[model samples]
Target: MGEKHRSRWVETLVLLVRNPMAVASSLVLLVLVIVGVFGDVLAPYGYNEQFVGDQLESPSGSHWFGTDDFGRDVFSRVLLGAEVSLRVGAVAVGISLVAGVLIGLLAGYYGRWIDDALMRFMDMLFAFPALLMAIAVLAILGRGETNAMVAIGIVYTPIFARVTRASVLTVREEVFIRASRASGAGDFRIIFRHVLPNAAPPIIVQTTISLAFAILSEAALSFIGLGTQPPDPSWGRMLSEGRGFIEQAWWMALFPGLAIFVTVLAFNVLGDALRDVLDPRQRSALSGKGAAR
Candidate 1:
């Protein structure tokens, strides 16, 4: 079956399942995602509803994780904020993944004018610092979650494109690929079935890492007032507002910061694990070492 065949591509999943830290982090992220997706039902209080008497209240039975300056439940806002973070992360990475992989495939596989032109364009795009590039896009487009996602996607495309192109170049010269061409397989079929399968590992790894970057970029943009605006419950805006009261209302900032940290760390760790599993060189080295021992 297609599902079973696809499952075999990730032998890394077995190794990841064995890693306690990865498992724990993955569990935490899963819980957060569930809360984010169903926050309306899971959160006890409305994200923006004010509890006048509970303003800046410390953790208590009635108000957990304390209350913000406006007496809004920090717990509720954080849950709602997760929705924004995850949405931006998923959507932005998806956009970059598609655009980057297409560009990278054409450039690396075809070579000649296509490769040179595409790579040079990527070089120019890569020159701008991510924050500045995002700012420029947001400035022209005005501010909103959708616009912010676009900005983040633009910033991340280079990462996926470069990795994909390198993988494609490597795979294109492999004997299997040469044989596929010698058999008179169409260019499209060769590229899709032979080249892409081999090229996908690095691209997938980059996608996981890019998700983290996208989340961070969204947070930064929100912090600067260019992202998910007022009462929308984004972690960056929460951190920005909480900065003024950090000494007095530390929970407001602490929880969101921790959420971002742990989420990014989980993705990075998973990416590294996937890289180890996916790389043939690494697998061969491990096998060789095992034999020697």
Candidate 2:
């Protein structure tokens, strides 16, 4: 029994690890996340500390990625900026996921008026452009990274709710779910133990994909001056500041923009790969392989 359980878990791990795209993306994301978590230690200079003599220096042996207009080390600032981007993205996605999952569970399990009402509410949110809704929320909440996160979270919640609701609707009717009900499983036990666990794979994939969008939204908000204030280095804000002097100092914008591009692309690719790996069909195939072996 122990060996079989361990073998099943290993097979699942193998399935996830076997996809080259997923593996690569996951590795890249891991690096970025580590950098974000430990940027202060990894960065050569403080994000806010200015180097008076090194303003706007191009990439060189000493400066690496070079210096910005404020004489801060561009490389260090970008590293620290990664922390901000990831923090915002992770926090926003987490909040949205929790809210979405709960609302979806209620809508899916209850059905009838509850389903219709919840879905219509979600549709209303879906109708509003994410950027527009986020902008409005930020405007009302005032300019700050935390507030921006709240805005992004609210903007993305509807998508998660919709996905979760659909997944739950399908899963609720499954034969195993019916058997659980017949076995006298309490509603809460059935949901927590069986329904949510089975429903989580696609939701997990969606959340990973949403991380990219969340980061992008944070960048957009910061670029518009509604995010991370002065002295707090932010990639989006850095790009905004670099726009005017792009021709004269290309490194100012290039490095930060590249960081954003690579990170977002990594998450998106990873999400797609995870979807394939965790697919129920793939899971069944891997189980068959395990049994055969």
Winning model by lDDT:
2
Residue-by-residue lDDT tens digits, candidate 1, 1-293: 35654775655575566557767867877887898789899888888999877789887887778899999999888888999999999998988888889899999999999999998998899999999999999999999999999988888888778988999999899998899889999889988888888788888888878887899899999999999999889999999989999999999898888878888888888777667767878755644655576
lDDT of each: 0.86, 0.89
Candidate 2 residue 263 C-alpha distance from true site, Å: 0.4
What is the per-residue lDDT of model 2 for residues 49-112, given as tens digits with 9 covering 90 to 100? 8889888999887778898888888999999999999999999999999999989988998899
Q: The CA-based lDDT of model 2 is what?
A: 0.89
Candidate 1 to truth, TM: 0.93
Q: What value does the lDDT take at residue 125 in candidate 1? A: 90
Distance from true position, residue 262, model 1, in Å? Answer: 1.2
Q: In angstroms, give how far residue 251 of model 1 lies from its true place.
A: 1.4
